[model samples]
Structure formats: C-alpha cells, structure tokens
Target: MPLTFEDLLARARALPRLGHRALLGIAGSPGAGKSTLAEQLVRTLNGEGEPWVAHVPMDGFHLADVELDRLGRRDRKGAPDTFDAAGYAALLRRLREERDEGGEVVYAPGFERVLEQPLAGAIAVPPTARLVVTEGNYLLLDTGAWSRVRAQLDEVWFCAPDEDERVRRLVARHEEFGKSHQEAVAWVLRSDERNARLVAATRERADLVVRDLVGWPDRHGRPRTGGEPGPVGTDTGC
Candidate 1:
C-alpha cells in the first residue's frame, strides 16, 4: 500500500509529542508543492479539534525591492542571497526556545504577494499553537545563515515532483501573480530554474523526501494566487 495524505497527517500529528513545540519544515524547488502541502497539513490536522497548528512561511524574509535595488540583487529576487536568512534563522530559534509564559504571542512576518514585500508582525502564533509548519526553498541548505535553519526544525521534508510539471506550475504561478505569460516563462527558465537547481542539490539533507502526495488537487484545478499550484505529476525529480 502507498503512503497517503492521511499517513502524512499522522506523521505531522506526532511531531508535537517529541517536545513542548515542534517545527516542521517543508523544502522544495520552485513549484514543487511545498506551500500547498504545508497548508493542507495544517488545515486537516487542526480540523480534528481545537487548532493547535500554525503556518509560518519563510517568504516573509524576502528582502524588499528597495533593499534589493540598493544591493543590486533585484534580478535574482528568489535567490537565497535576496532574503534575510539570518533573520529567518533567528525567528525559528525564538519559536523553538520561547514558550508561552503567560499568554505570550510570537509574531512572525508575512509576505504580501501583490506588493512583493515583507510585512512585519503579520502572523500571530498564540500560546495554544504546539506545531508550526514552515515552508521554503532553502530550509535544507547548508550554506551561510541557512545552516542554522535546519537545526531549528524537528524534521524537514523535501517535496520532489516531476520536472516538467514543476516548471509548468512555476510559469502559471507567475502568470497568476501579474506577469505576462511570456515574462513568466522567461523568468521561470532564467531565474527560478537557477534557484531550483540550488535547492535540488540540498534534497539529500532532508529527513523525508515526499514524492507524490496522493489525493492532492491536480495542477489544472483552480489555482491559488500567492501559493503553489496543486500537486500534479508522477516523476519524482526535485
């Protein structure tokens, strides 16, 4: 029998049992369904009863366009250097070490899709949250400040779907987010592909490699604006 989404849910549900609070990291190349899987896990696991799971995306650490301009890295916005890796690592550390002493809330930054900027204190993790699901492209990366990220997570899972499907999803994602089809395709091949290759090299470092998640929506399904397209594909190439 194959491992279904229910099996994945069971794994996620058991995470908090390992400690006071557990952070689950989902890493993947562009359009590999990292965000979508994380979202579903949080939703289904919390649906059982009172919500104890939280979703905190690493996209919030993206450097604003202005900073990218100053740094002359605007061309490679999705590259690892275009983000505040150190800041993200620190936030993960805080999330792991800090407990709700007396109804304390740990706020996290969020990414504004339309504006393509990071919004501070956009997400609130209340005292009730025991599991935090964070998805990003570089969680397993061992370079620079990114090296600190994996240490903060209880376990990290890498999403590896088919290459062609991943590229198609990346194209569609850019189009839905305001880019012209041609521009989206060009960006995917030029920029996103480069970043994707870097992320793929880090796959072996993950605790689990999720190939295909059974029952996930197909790519042709109604698309999400700021998140990954539905999981569609058979080949497991990250």
Candidate 2:
C-alpha cells in the first residue's frame, strides 16, 4: 500500500527524538518530481513557522560546468560522475554528528543551473535543525560514490509517477530550460532514459515509494488517492 503524505510527515516527525539527525532521502529518476515533493514536504512540515527541517539537495554538489567541460563530460552533465558525491557524503556526516551550538551555522554547496556552476557555501544548515531532507538522483544507486549515499540516510523514499506524464514533464522541463524541442526529445531519449533505467532498478531498495499528486477525478469525478496511481518511468533527468 502507498503511504499518504501526512503519514510520511508523521514518520519524519518521529525521527528527531531518536538522538541523531534524521536524514530523509528523496530520490528518483530525472523529472520524477523529487525536488518538487521535497519542497512540498518541507513547506508542510514548517508551515507553522517552526523551521525544524532543512533540504540538502544532491544537485547542489554537481561539479561546475568548466570542470565538466575540462573532463570532457559536458554531454553527460547529470551522470553520477558529474557530481561531488564524496563531498556530499562528508557534509551529511557533519550534519549528523555536530551538536547544535545555538547560533552556529554550517555552510553547504548549491548548484546554479543558469550559470552551469556550483556555488560554494550557498546553503546553510543551521545547528538547530533536526531533520535534514536530501533529494537527488543517485541516493539509492548501488555502485561507486552513490553506494555510500543511502547508508547515511535514516529513510529513503522513491517517488514514481506515470510514464507518459513523466516524459511529458521532462520534455516540458527541457524546453523551459532553454533546450530546443528536438534537443529536448533527444536528451530525454538518450541521457535521461539511461539515467531512468538506472534509477528504476533501485526502487526495491527504497523504504517507501511515493506516488505523484493527483487532482479532481477520473471519468466518474470521484476523489483519487495520490498514493497508488500507476507505474511511471523512473527518469529524474535534472
């Protein structure tokens, strides 16, 4: 059975009393709505203005564009090798171990899509935060640097959406990001599809699988549950 959004939030709230920082991983293939869901979760959790959670996205650790071009990997920008996974792992460790010293703040990395570069110290994880929700593509990947990502998380959620809808969203995202329609399609078919396959293989490893949000109803106009919808392509081509 699929877990409701409120159920997931309750799970997150329970982790803080366990004496260590809770690392909730939100991972999925390109355009799988990982970021969107993470944002919604944080907003919902902090809507009362307590600010108990902070988001640490893996995309923030992506290597700068010049570095990718230098390494001749520009064509594979979203590949696992294109990110500073080790650095991300290290930060996670720090976030878990360091005790809150009142006003002390820890700076982390962030990625800039328009500039195609990684901005250093762009994210600040405050000492008081109890839940650190990190979202990215390779959190559950079983090999290389990605393998270590999951071990650091208290729980991991894999977000899956309908296949045709996912592809449509990806194409739209590509177009919004300045890719020509043809280029977008080619990228989806080539790069995004490859990553999607890799991400899908990790679903069985996830602690929870999330379904995309739905509205209205089908032909009958009955309210639909957002949890158990349909199988979607596991492509998070961010």
Candidate 3:
C-alpha cells in the first residue's frame, strides 16, 4: 500500500540531521505532481517554523538552446539526455560539502522555458539551508547520467497519480505553455507518456510512495481528509 501525502511529509521531517546536509529528492512522471508536492512541502515546512528548507530543481541543469540544437535534441527537449546530469550531480555533491564558510553564495544553474536556455548562477542555495528539496523527472532513472543522482540524495519520494489524470494534466500543461491543443495532446501521447512509463518503473526504489487522494486535505496548509484531490497544478518548469 502507498502512503498518503501527509505520511510522506512526516517521514521527511523525521530524517536525522546529517553533519553535512540533507538532500530530499521528489521524483515522479512528467505530470504526476512531483514539483507541486515539493513546493508545497517546502512552503508548509517553512510556514510551520522550519526555515532551513531550500529547493534545487533538476530542470535547472538543462543544456542551453544552442547545445541542444547542436545535439539535435530540441524537439525532444525533456528527454533524459537533454540535461547536464553529471553537472547536476556535481552540484549536489558540492552542496553537501560547502558549508556557509566565508559567506560564499553557492550559485546553481537554472533552465529558462521561455528563453529555452540554461543560465548559470540563476539559483543560489545558501549555506544556511539544512534541507534541500530537489525535484525532477529522472532522479530515480537507473541508467546513464541519472544513476549518479539517486546516490547523492538522503531520501527519495515517488509520486503516483492515476494515468488518466496524469495525461490530462500533461495536456493542460503543454497547452498552457503555448502549444496548440492538438500538439499538446500529441506530445503528451508521444513524449510525456514515454517518460511517465520510465518514471513509473522506479517507484520501488523510493523511500515512500505518495498517492494524491481526490479530496484529501491541502496537505501543505491546513488539515483535512477525503479522497485524493485532483493532481496538484504547478509549473516549476520540471
């Protein structure tokens, strides 16, 4: 049986503080609400008086438009190969080691959707942050560049939603990002679906599996209980 969102939160909060830092990876299919859940967790934890939480997204490591063009992978922009996975892993390692010594700001890269380029130093993870919540599509991917990422995290949570809902959200997301409805549907069926299948297979590796009930509480803000809610709608660019 899968745990509810609240169960996942409690599990994360219970992690022992490491001398270095804590890295929490939230992974899921393309439209399975991983980014939304991650953001909600950070916000909720901060609001509840945990101020040391920060976010470092994998999408931030996507290659620049020119590089993608050179590699001829622009059309398949969200594919695993489209990102600089090794660089991302290196940054995670650095984050675990670099304390707040000398007030040096740890600059991390970020991907720009509208501009379709990766900008270095777009995000800075301060040393004061004790909990880093990183979310993406390939965190648990077992092959290639993604394999290194899983080993760097203290814990990993996999989000699972109904397939119909996931597809609906993906289509909506694509359309919201300026794709035509037809194009969005096609992309969801062609690219996003493929990625989702790959992601779904990694659930067994997660420390916890979260099933977003339809009417469940706004697990981030207040407390309520019911069927799982519709998938969380958020555009964290992952």
Candidate 4:
C-alpha cells in the first residue's frame, strides 16, 4: 500500500518517546523531496506547541564555494567530497549527546540557496527539542566518512518520487536559487543527475522509503503523479 502523510507523522511522533533525543535522517537525490518530508514532519509535529522538534539539513555542511574552487571541485559542488563529511558527522554526534542538561542552545549552520554559502549558527536546536530531523543526499552512503553519519541517526528514511517530478523539482530549485532556466536544466543534466544516481543506490540502506510527498505543479499545470494529489502549489525543493 502507498504510504500516507499521516503514517509518516505517526512515526515521527514516536521518536521522542524512545528514551533519548532522537535524530531522523531523510535521504534522497537532489530533488527527491527529502527536505520537504523533513520540514513537514518537523513543522507538523511541533504545531501549536512548545517546539519539541528541530530541523538541520546536511546542506549546511557544504564546503564554501571558495573552498571548492581552491580544491578545483567547483563544478561538482554537490558531490560528497564537496562537503565537510567528518564535521557533519561530528555535529550529529554532538547533537545527539547534548541535551537541555545545561540549558544551553545548540546552533547549526544553514545553507543559503541564493548566496550558495553555509551560514554558521543559523539554526538553533532548543534544549526542549527532543527530535532532530535532518535531510541530505549522502546520509545512507557507506563510502568514506559518510558512513559515520548513519551511526548518529536513529533512523534514516529515503525519499523516492516519480522520475519526471524529481527532475522538474530539481530544475526549479536551481532556477529559484539564482540560475537561469537554461543553466538550471544544464546543471540538472550534467551534475545533479549523477548525484541522483548515487543517492538512488543508497535507498536500499534506509530504514524506510517514502513515496507520496506532493503539491508540485507539473509543466502544463497538470498533476504529475496520477491523481493521488491534485495541483496545489510549488514544492519545497530539498
């Protein structure tokens, strides 16, 4: 049976009850709705409340563009090595261990789509926060330092959407982040697709596979993935 949003929400609600602060990783290709799922879960879980859930995306660990240029990897900006893998793993470990014990706030960096930079201390995981939802491409990858990431996450969910919708969301994300339509298309084809393939390979390693996130308009303003979800508005590009 197809998974529903309520099913996902119920799963999230159970995380905080698991003894300690829990970290949930959402993994997928560039446009597989990882961010959307993580964001919605965090948002909905904390609705009209004291905020027990927190969100921290792995995109925040992206090495700065200047650093990428220095290492001559600017073209492959979204590649695994293009980020600080070890640092990200370390942060996850710290987040899992740190609690409201001292009543201190935990700050995480955030990525700016427009400026294409990692902003430090952008997100604060409050002391009362018991669930941390993080989304990224390489969460399930077992290669190199990326393997350390999974150990920190209590569970990782992989997002897999229809092929065409994935591409459209990816392209639209690029355009929204400052690229021209032509440039966005080119990047999606040349770079994002490769990362997508790598991420797809890691899907089998995730604890769950999520497939029904919705609301993105199709090219002709028609629904893309059958009629499961009708046209609403734009997607929250992850």
Candidate 5:
C-alpha cells in the first residue's frame, strides 16, 4: 500500500519516544518537497499545544555569499561544499546534549531568503522540544562532515517525487525568488541539476523513501500524486 501522510506523522511522532529528544532528517534533491514535508510534520505534530516539535532547517548553515565568492565557488552556491557542514554537525550534537542534560535554550541560525544570507541566532529551540525536524539536501550523504550528520539523525527520510514535476517546481522556485524565467531555467539546468544528482545518489541511505509527498486530496477526498502544481515556496532552492 502507498504510504499516506498519516503514516509519516506516526513514524515521526514515534522518534521522540526512543530517547529524551530525537533528530529527524529529511533529505532529497532540489524541489523534491523536503522543506514542505518537514514544515507540515512540525506544524501538525505541535498542533495547538505547547509546541514540542521544533524545526531547524540546514539552510541556516549555508555559507554566506561573500564566503562563497572568496572561496571561488559562488557558481555552485547550493552544492554540498557551499555549506558549513562541520558547524551544522556540531549544532546537532549540541542539540542532543542539551536534550539529555535538560539545559538552557539553544539558538540556531536561519537563512534569509530575500537576502540569501545566513542569519545567526534566528531560531530558538527550547528544552521543551522533544523532537527536532531538520531538512536539507545533503543529510544522507556519506562523505566528509555530512557523514557526521547522518550519525546524529535518529532516522532520515528522502523525498522522491516525479522527476518532471520536481524540475518544474525548481524552475518556478527560482522565479519566485526574483529570477527571470530564462535565468531560472538556466540555473536549474546548470547548477541545481548537478546538486540534485548528488542528492539523488544518497537516496539509498534514507530509512524511508517518500515517493508521493507532493500529492493531496481532492474535493471528494481522493489521493493525488504529482497532479497539483504551483509555487513551492521554501520547499525548493534551499
């Protein structure tokens, strides 16, 4: 049977039960809905209650544009090397330590979409949070500091939507972020596609492969997969 959103919710809800706090990693190619699914899980789990689920996206660890320029890798801005992977790993370790010791609040950096920069001390994860949902493109990569990242995650899920739909969403996302249609298409093909291929290669490492997360119910409550289309917002180009 195809996995429903409820099944994903149940799986994510069970993570915190394993220990004091659990880290859930969502990894996927560009425009595969990793951020969207993570956001929904955190929102639905917390409900209208005290907010036990906190979202800590890996986008915050993205290297600043200036740093990328200095490193002469600005053209491959979203590639794995364009991020502070080690710093992100340290942050995850800190989150686990704080969860175990019942320590003070931990602040995480956040990415400013319009400015395309990492903002420090932007997200606060309190000790009350029992589950931290972090999503990124390279969480399942088994090389370099990314390997340390996978070790920290309790379970990692990979988003695998239809390839054509994913590409469309990627192009649209670039346009939404202030790029011309032609420019968006060019970037998607030249830069994002390369990163996407790298991300796809790590799919086998995920504990779960979600092939239909972008689907939704119709007016009659029928399940639809990759039939709906629109802007993906923060779901892509992260």
Candidate 6:
C-alpha cells in the first residue's frame, strides 16, 4: 500500500497525456525534500538522453527583497504571502499550453540563494519537454492565488520526513548557505519552522504524502559550499 520511490518514478514517467504536457507538483514543509525528489524524478526519467522533463521550482516566485521590503514582509520571506502566487499559476498554465501547442520554448525563472533573488527566465522548458516537474513549500496552500496553483497541476505530492530530521536538514542547509551555526539554528527555529507548520497543514490536500527520504548522506557527496539547493533527491534543497 506504499508508494515506493520507484512507484513515484513510474507514475511520473507516465504522466504526459496523448500529445499534451503533464505538470507534476511536489509540495512539502521546509526541508521536506520536495526539490530533491522532483530533481531525481526528472533526472532518472530523462536518463542519459535529451531532457524531456523540465524542473520548474516555485522558489522562483519568491518576492524579490526590494518587493518584500516594500511590502514590509522581508522578515517572513518564505511565507505564503511573500511570493507571487498568481504569477506562478500563470506560468504553469503557460507551460502546459506551450507544450500542448508544440510552440516555442518556455522560459521559467530560477532562484539564487546566494543573492536571495529571482533571476528571470533562468530555466528553460524546451518544446520537446513533455513533463514539468515543480516543487515548493506552498504548492497545496489554499490561500489567495495559491489555490489556483493546484488547478494548473495534474498531481501534487506532499513530501514529509521525520520532523527532527527535517529540522536538522533545514539547519544544515542554512549553514551551507553561509549562515553561522547559531544563525542557522536560530533562523530555522524562528522562520523555517513557521513555514513548515503552514505547509504541513496542507498535506491532506496533496495526492500523495511521501515520507521516505532516499538517503541522508552528504547529498551529491559534494562539498557543501553552495548556497543554492539543487537535485538533492539524494538535501533539504527539496
């Protein structure tokens, strides 16, 4: 009765409908491994060939610092209201439409952790891409425009790991991103935890609750020097 990693992969591999694009959303609390799983799914599915699966993370929608400062919500950067939810939904819709119409390449934005800014058109969804894999902390959120995100997605899976492990990963991630241990620990408790609780509240709204983490080893076994989180399907970068 469990959805193994392989099962998830199989389901993702089969998501595209006849001549239409498929949008798969991964939702989870902070450090729940959503990004990791999405990346792994796309990577494994694409194998060594051309990429048919494209990764479009919701982090790109995070409000720029200037905007957040203007809104006076900079302290709560990861909160639901801190992102351009409506814009994100619009992109999802466009990605699907472009894929379905077999039109020009679809360009998506990317988030830069070091600068804590969103780079426009940083990610490209090729015309050949049939599946769009997206992950974020608020995919299942029902607030404001967030509710519309679910409509654009074919399926949304919730990633949930042990709370303690999630916290550990979150702290480590912050440290890897240049925050001192104390600062990382403090930020995790003060900020990330709040976001995590909000995200956890939406778990029931997801199509699947993924609890297992593939591994906890130094993800990608790479030295933890980068602030950006990548396919940690193998870090909380999820």
lDDT of each: 0.84, 0.78, 0.76, 0.82, 0.84, 0.81
For candidate 5, the TM-score is: 0.90
Candidate 5 C-alpha lDDT tens digits along 35-145: 877887787788758789999999999999999999999999999999999999999999877753547899999999889899999999998889999999999888899
lDDT of 4 by residue, 38-155 (tens): 7767767777487899999999999999999999999999999999999999999998987666756889999998899999999998878899999999999999999999999988
Q: Best-fitting candidate, measured by lDDT?
A: 1
lDDT agreement of model 6 with the native: 0.81
* RMSD list, candidates in order: 4.0, 5.4, 4.7, 5.1, 5.0, 5.0
In candidate 2, what are the lDDT values of residues 25-53, reduced to their tens digit?
98888988787778767777777677889
Residue 69 displacement (Å), model 2: 1.3
Clashes of 6: 2
Q: Summarize candidate 3's per-residue lDDT along 97-151 as a digit string, tens digits.
A: 7665554568888767667577888888887777789999899888987899989
Instruction: Say what the RMSD of model 6 is.
Output: 5.0
Residue 18 in model 5: shift from native, Å?
Answer: 6.4
Q: Which segments of candidate 4 are over 4 A away from where they belong?
A: 212-238
Model 2 alpha-carbon miss at residue 137, Å? 0.8
lDDT of 6 by residue, 1-238 (tens): 5444567777788889888999999998988777777777777778758778999999999989999999999988898989999999999999878744638988888999888899999998888889999999998889799999998999888877767877888898899889999999988888999888888888888876777454322235343333333322322222
Q: Clash totals for all models, in order?
A: 0, 7, 8, 0, 0, 2
Candidate 4 CA-lDDT value? 0.82
Candidate rank order under lDDT: 1, 5, 4, 6, 2, 3
* Worst-scoring 10-residue span by lDDT in model 4: 229-238
Residue pair clashes in candidate 4: none
Pairs that clash in candidate 6: 35-238, 36-233
